[model samples]
Target: MLLIIVGTACGAPDTTAAEGTPETLETFTTTADALTVQNCSPLPTSSVLASGDDGAGSVANNTRDDRLDTRWSALGKGVWIDYDLGSVQSLSGAAIAWHQGNTRVNTFTLYVSTDGVNYTQVYTGKSSGTTTAAETYTFATRTARRLRITVYGNTLNDWASIAEARVCGAPATGSSVVWRGDFETGNISQWTSTQMVSADRLQVISSPVRSGKYALKATVRQGDDPINSSGNRNELVKMTREAVGSEYYYRWSTMFASDFPSVKTWQLFTQWHHEGSSGSPPLEFYVYGEEIRLNIGGDPGTLVWKAPLVRGQWQDFILHVKWSPEASVGFVELYHNGQLVLPKRNIATMFPGMLNYLKVGLYRSDTVTQVGVVYHDGWIMARTLADVL
Candidate 1:
């Protein structure tokens, strides 16, 4: 959800009425627009790990209260506050208003983590030290769950303070495991949007789960065109829109039902669809008769990898790709159930000038007579293999 943070000495601005959920950015506001801004949105923020607080007025909530007069102040150096985005996200930067920004500079470092155990430092610098107004700090885009700001005292003394702050989300490119569509929320709320005929087509179930407390049971019968699209599909989407030069690792598990249609046609379970929407996706994971296949390019794309399909058994996959339109620069790698099924192979991962987004569920040629069912869970996208593992 986008939130507008007005940098006036007054208070926060009146945001648009789209405060329904806390993720869809345009639903609120932005930071680059200096006059109106937000404390901790574009990415939702909730304190996860924090040092002791100074007092009641100086609580951690003050950092996001939309008021410059109130601050989250604490004594001594090395004090910090961490925010959990509820789910992994592609974070780009941070906007912070120091406790006494106009008077003193606060030395601080920015760190991020996936599981909240191991942290990686992303940015380190001092606040503007000139204005109590919020300052924006940019860094290389990264994928993670939590953001922590550690302060090492300001210019005045060993006192750490933050009037307001926020971690910004990069809706496009990222390196680490930035998101999960594992049905962890007991629903499909984690995804950017959906293309389902009905909620019943894509359901979250507790039993028959591969990991976590739930799994998605996607069902599709013939002629189920939820969005009145060309093909029959019931899918949940993650709008990655990964740019050229971007690389990422993805992990997920899927199981086809024993009664899944075995027609000698394409039944796509997952795909990185190009934005052009006119032809086959650049990359796709599908079932062709009794075999599972991974294809790259379009139409009659090159089949990079394939294996015999096994029904009623969880199939785990870790896919690594460098998203480039050039064959020499882009590549794809795959590991199935902990085995190196496909080594890194250079190829064009995207159509030139076109972006890609994720769709996972059951999409297939609608001519088949039998119903199709598939279970999916534990979907994660990261920059490194270790992060998804």
Candidate 2:
């Protein structure tokens, strides 16, 4: 049975709407879009914070109110609020009110704004790891008062409570903020999350680990594949953000623990589903549904590897995909580390011209029931094919 899981467990995409559920961003209708009030508050004067159940004090009414389509965790330290800035504020610093006792293990980020339409990040936390943890940074005073806090809890059920959040300082001289994701310091601005398991199954890890310097890792135990998207004991990864175009480059290095059995069907896949389309079909490159398609027995584009990917070692992947006016005439090139494993100029084919996003993670189901983990890092860039190559 499908448990309500938590708050309005988002039903799959309703393409009928302008933007799918995941892309349905909330726009602020008041001044309080500037504050994030949680667990403790009378609701700020000008904030978008709303009161929601954190799985306690209420029965069927228990729910988590997070902006992103997915919840941070089923464990419940995950309560958040987000709002679109109608106009950027001259944000300088913030005053956070904590209801629960202070904690020293939760991390948060602060994003900036200008037009209140797009966001740019300003400050990130390096130390204060609690809801009571107040931090100030030198962002040269920007005109972005809007923010989104993605709380990463270090302690499992130790929830972080926020009474109020405030932005201080006047707008920066001439700086106009466009886009931002709270408190992201480094490459976190490019980060995204996806929940591939059906809600009926138990998926405790709301966030994956960043392996290597910037690797996106996927770890699973022996009986991890509850939904069996790929059959066998497997795990799947899908994009959290959507992107479509003809001139983008994505590169990342990967390493997998060799638990794949010799007789199991293992393959890497990139599934893309358009915004308003319906079907169980997925756009794939290496493996198309139940068949192998890559660099092995068939044409390079549709061949499957006789030998499985090397395990216990790191492998670099450099992908350059370019769009052609002919819709289905695009090109895809894959490079292993520095060496070209899947040659350039190869014509790999998949789905309807436009794409919502790309899934760049591991998809495997070994013959033997065992554990599996894939680690990745390095640069994740989305730029012109020329800039990437």
Candidate 3:
């Protein structure tokens, strides 16, 4: 009997799958007006200095000298490296660690400087050549004292090594995280999913995580099929960035499955969707029978908030929002577990020109069959709320 309709747009729509196209909205900007540095530190040593190296465990301080069997190599094509950090400092992100980096792929470019000769590029990608582990890379926090790395060749030879090199940032006061996914390097390669059809839905579990060691299991059965065939998905990850009009501060941690299945049609476990064409999802959180609702959509949809789904522990969430489709500049707040349960509230999260993108796992309705399981953990995305509460 699935009918909780608020403003319409819910259910029915699977004309044989395939629909995704929308996307193309851009316009982000908001470093919160920059310049905040309230006591930053971290950059004690990495005074590296290279343009050549290839001797004694591969020199250049073996990439910060942490030793994963040591390395720094460098040989042809543009190769460079620097690190200094004696002052300006206020950056955010960089983890590196690639000696064989799982055997290949590695193009790079990241720069920042306060004087090591005036640089400033910030980042450029490529590196999942997974061999010695490490990997992490985040950006958009800026402020620097010199940290360069420019490779430009890899997929095998021309060699650029680098076995360890971290940098992370803090001490800049007003918060700004912008993406995090605490799988702690056990790997989910960060995350992105169009509803991956099975590798067991999505995984990276170590023991149920709330902090670290890894956690992000999804799993949804009942025929599990609907990557676009309209609803009945197995969700998995989905956050390849996209949020407009700024103001974010999400956080995460969920858990369920103590038999979890009090279905009534519609199960969504997190969403923000909207990029247009086909509705419902201006925000959602879902599950109706055993409570735990939120929805939002527009033109009549609203369910505001709800709770009471207990099952098996771990909940936590933060969500701040500000986005906008204008209802006097959108709003929404919520805490749960840190308790502020839905405070600000104004609505209109988006649907004009569209923007908003995020997704978690296990969407339902297709006549519920059962077999679901959740368990996510520390997925951040900040810009304050003290960088994801």
TM-score of every model? 0.58, 0.39, 0.31
Write one digit per residue (lDDT tens) for candidate 2, span 1-389: 11111211111221232212232212212222122222221111234542243554321111122111212222243444443334554555444543332555445555665544465766655334454422333455565546554444444344544443444444324432222211123333343444334332212222232233233445544444444332222222333222121234566555555563332234443333332233212233332223323431111123422224566676555566542212233456666557665555534222232233444444443322554455545545443433334
Tens digit of per-residue lDDT, candidate 1, span 192-231: 8878888899999998999989999999999987765544
lDDT: worst 10-residue window of model 3? 30-39
Scored by Cα lDDT, where does model 3 land?
0.67
Using lDDT, give the best candidate's number: 1
Q: Which ten residues in a row have the lowest lDDT in candidate 1?
A: 5-14
Task: Order the candidate numbers by TM-score, best to worst.
Answer: 1, 2, 3
User: Which lDDT tens digits does candidate 3 get at residues 1-389?
Assistant: 11122222433222222223322223422222111111222234436788987765588776653445667887886788887756775776666777878888889988888888788888888898865656767677788877788888798787888776756564347556756876787867676654656777778889878887898788777767644445566665554334233466788988887888986556778877764545566778877677887767532357788888987898998988766555555688989899998898887676544455677877766566777888888888866787676
Model 3 alpha-carbon drift over 4 Å, by segment: 1-67, 74-79, 82-146, 149-163, 177-192, 196-221, 225-233, 236-250, 253-259, 262-315, 318-336, 339-359, 363-380, 383-389
Please give the ranking of all candidate structures by lDDT, highest first, separated by commas: 1, 3, 2
Error of 3 at 20 (Å): 35
Residue 29 shift from truth in candidate 1, angstroms: 36
